[model samples]
Target: MTDTSEMDRRAELSEFLRNRRARLKPEQAGIQPFGGRRRVPGLRREELAYLAGMSVDYYIRLEQGKVRNVSEPILEALTRALSLSEDERAYLRNLVKPSHRRPVSRPKVLPGLLRLLDMAEGVPAYVVGHRADVLAWNGLASAVFTDFAALSPRDRNWARMIFLNRSVQAVFADWTSKGRDTVAYLRVQAASHPGDAELAALVGELSVKSDHFRTWWAAHHVRDHARGRKRFIHPLVGEMTLDFECLRPADGGDQTLVVYTAEAGAASERALRLLANWGADAATGAEAGEPEVGRL
Candidate 1:
């Protein structure tokens, strides 16, 4: 790596450790508070070092990103001391020892995958690539989310839409929660793709334009969009709740197939049906009859 990139990596790693440490309370870590006024919100460096069973100087060096080739046992100790979640632990691993990142290239959704999306008739389904790019979408997905087909290629990112698009912001019932999740997902992607200029530019743009994005990015949170429930206040269909599942391909690529489903006999199901009908009508009017798929 270039010196500049190495410095950037070290800085990121340091900030991540600091934020994680700052969120952990001394009491929560079973540390007894001592006699002075505590200046920080969370556990002090010495307390953390004590919990991790390491020397204060060694822990300080690790926290400062000065330690190289951090051992597995040391990492495990820190993981326990910080009480990191599964996703957070994975992110910690990436930061301390990031893998060799491949070149960034536009990911293409396979024709077979497009067909799979089409077959998911009653549900909203889409494919998202490494940078949260909307690589492909089924009709219901376009209806539930914004019309991915209508967006400019660059505007088809979930993070961009969540942070920058007013209509999208209004659609999610809990916009802030959704926004934070988007930010966390982006952080995870950044750790994996440190050399991706487009990804970095996207983060920089969102950080500039959205206060929520800026704050959440600085928090150093990391998450995987594996499965979750989302509430939507869609314009046409008043309100609905849906459960989403993110399925990754066996090859372990960044492409994820996300599908959203509503309860079988719930009001949300009815709303989805209405949205599907509306989407079909909209589809008929378009000169391009097929749903826009694999447009990366």
Candidate 2:
């Protein structure tokens, strides 16, 4: 690699560390405040270094982008000190030791995958790509959430909807937490695909348009969007709580199949059935060339 490129990488690593450190409060790290008022928002450099079992000078050098040879043990200590999540730790490792492979093109949702999604009769399922673009979704997913077919291809993005669409905002029971987690998950993707123009543009747009996104992006929180419980405020069926799982193919493309399901005997399950039936009716009406009903 060129010296200039190396310097750029180091600069990014420095900025990431500084941002992570700034988000953590002194008390959160179990540090007692001294006599003077803190000019900085989070723990001081010395305190962080102490907690990481490193010298202040060494930590400063690391933060200054002067040290390139970081050991695993030191990285582990820093991870613990900053209270980094599993995804954050992996991102840190990537920053320190970036992959040499060429940038990957966006993965396409295969026909087989679409068939599988269609087979999920009562479940709401969608495939999300690297930039959280809703590549493909089942009719039940459209019924449960906003209809992706109605939106333009460029707007078929989870991050975009979470921030820009009022309908999406209304659907989430806890919009604040959902927004934060979405941004954090995007951060993880950004780290992995640093050269993706679409991802960069999306982040820039969201940062400019939404204060909530800007604040969460600056916090440097990272999370794996694997499994979680989500509460949705559906206009047709009222409120429903569902468990979601993210599945990846063995071939290892930058795509995940996300499925949301409610407990078998729960009210949420009944609501889901109602939603599926509604979707089927809508499809039938569309096939019969009936006027489309406006989204609720």
Candidate 3:
């Protein structure tokens, strides 16, 4: 609303466009490099404009944040020229045409959702808010991963745990891949809710705390957290591979219900059973006021 805020938004838009353009190589945009040595790392402004079927001056104005009335066709052309992913394309559109509505408050898991999570027997299920904060989790999920109940509310963020928690790092077979994907997913959320102070704080904290996160964030990669195969090396069970699906509630808040399941009669299934048993024991211990020792 203020002049300073408007300037900040435009500056952010400029930086995002520059970063995306810098990541696109000339060859990737079907452009042949000249004989002279180039100073830039990626496609030059003119090269990108040529690939997008637009004039160099027009593209320059768009990148400079001087053109606020960008058309859909032009945005689509830019998306294609930059080889943007679905999430990245959505983010770009949001930057050009931001919603007038304010950012929503942090979402809470509903009672029905908690009941459903509890009823999801033999499956590990958890609810994560827009910022990837673990709002709620079933006992099976706690056993399969880290115990969310043991963690403080502020420390329950998936992004923070992935970077700072050794137990979480140990569980993931490919930590780097998972970390990059997580950061990219968060980047999409940040673009959608640019005014969310909590999200901004999380990003700032992560950037200061983890070099890996800082580098990945600068890359501006974006991904939808829908479905994927996750491999884990459990401390109790040797190794397990699980299929995970992310579900959004019909109520349409920023909460996602993620469920992980193992294939029937497979080794992962047996390992899941072991995890369930251990989880049950852990729950019993908690009921008896014993310290939770199942955390790994």
Candidate 4:
């Protein structure tokens, strides 16, 4: 009897492979099309098998997740044949052979890291650990993004905020793109942390809740968060464009300290300055147990 987890993993593998294969057209792969009514969008099973230099039966079984112990060479062949991105390739490997090690139960927020966020008070900064949990955040981050301190620990996840919180969605100028990226990152996290029941539950909950999440999750897109320019329409500060960087702290147990900065002398810089002052003032005036200004 196949375990439920294993069956779920196999189903994910099959869907991911099929989606990747379906996106590459025959012309894109330099293959000449010979003929009958094309049923699917992209390369057929036999064509992909030919490109990967494997027998059709073997490739079909692999797609069906029936072939266990897939070799390195075979995986490499599939990577090339599908032209998977580095992130996508990593995701594929994880799906084929998931990690068995348990993740840190609760990632600690080091005092030094919190101090660093305090020191850089002018810009918005936050630390996100596994599963996009906003483990630690500065005042400016709450001002620019959301008041993470108010949310329960589980609801502090960026994935949850972006998908479930309508107010958070309104802040991002490119919310659709943001949602897609969040879904893709979560897809990578899901494959990488197969042992994480909380992570799995988060995905399941979002899939049931968000329409966009369900559609994008099925697309199988994968990417790592890096430096990017993002536009935000803050309720207090109005619109501002900021360049953000995701920095992984050494020995911080996979915690990424994300900082957002605007180009000097720009309107965004001025807006950030005003936002920082407002955030500081809000913090000073808040009564004990009072909720912060940015609820979502």
Question: Best-fitting candidate, measured by TM-score?
Answer: 1
lDDT of each: 0.82, 0.80, 0.80, 0.82
Per-residue lDDT tens digits for candidate 2, residues 165-247, read: 99988999999989998998887777776566678789989999999999888777778779999999999999999999988
User: Model 4, residue 269: what's the lDDT?
Assistant: 100
Which digits, one per residue and each the tens of the lDDT, describe model 1 over residues 1-296?
45655677788988988898899888898889654899988888888899999999998998888889988898899999999998888888887887776745666676566666667887888878889988877777878888777887688889999989999889899998999999999999888877777888899999899888998999898998799999999988799999999888777777888899999999999999988876664331111233444321
Put down candidate 3 lDDT per residue, 188-277, tens digits, no spaces: 787677677788889999999999999998787788769999899988898899999988878656777789999999999999988787
Return the number of clashes found in candidate 3.
0
Separate clash counts for every candidate: 0, 0, 0, 0
> lDDT by residue for model 4 over 1-296, one digit each (tens)?
88777787898999999999999998999888546889999999999999999999999999999988888899899999999998988889988888776877667766566566657768888777778888777678888887776777778889999999999999999999899989988888888877788888888999999999999988889998788889999888789999999877676355777889999999999999998776675331121233334321
* TM-score ranking, best first: 1, 4, 3, 2
For residue 246, model 2's alpha carbon misses the true position, in angstroms, by: 0.7
All candidates' TM-scores?
0.92, 0.84, 0.88, 0.90
Which parts of model 2 have CA positions greater than 4 angstroms off? 1-12, 23-38, 100-106, 110-112, 281-296
Better of 2 and 4 by TM-score: 4
Off by over 4 Å in 3: 1-8, 33-37, 250-252, 281-296
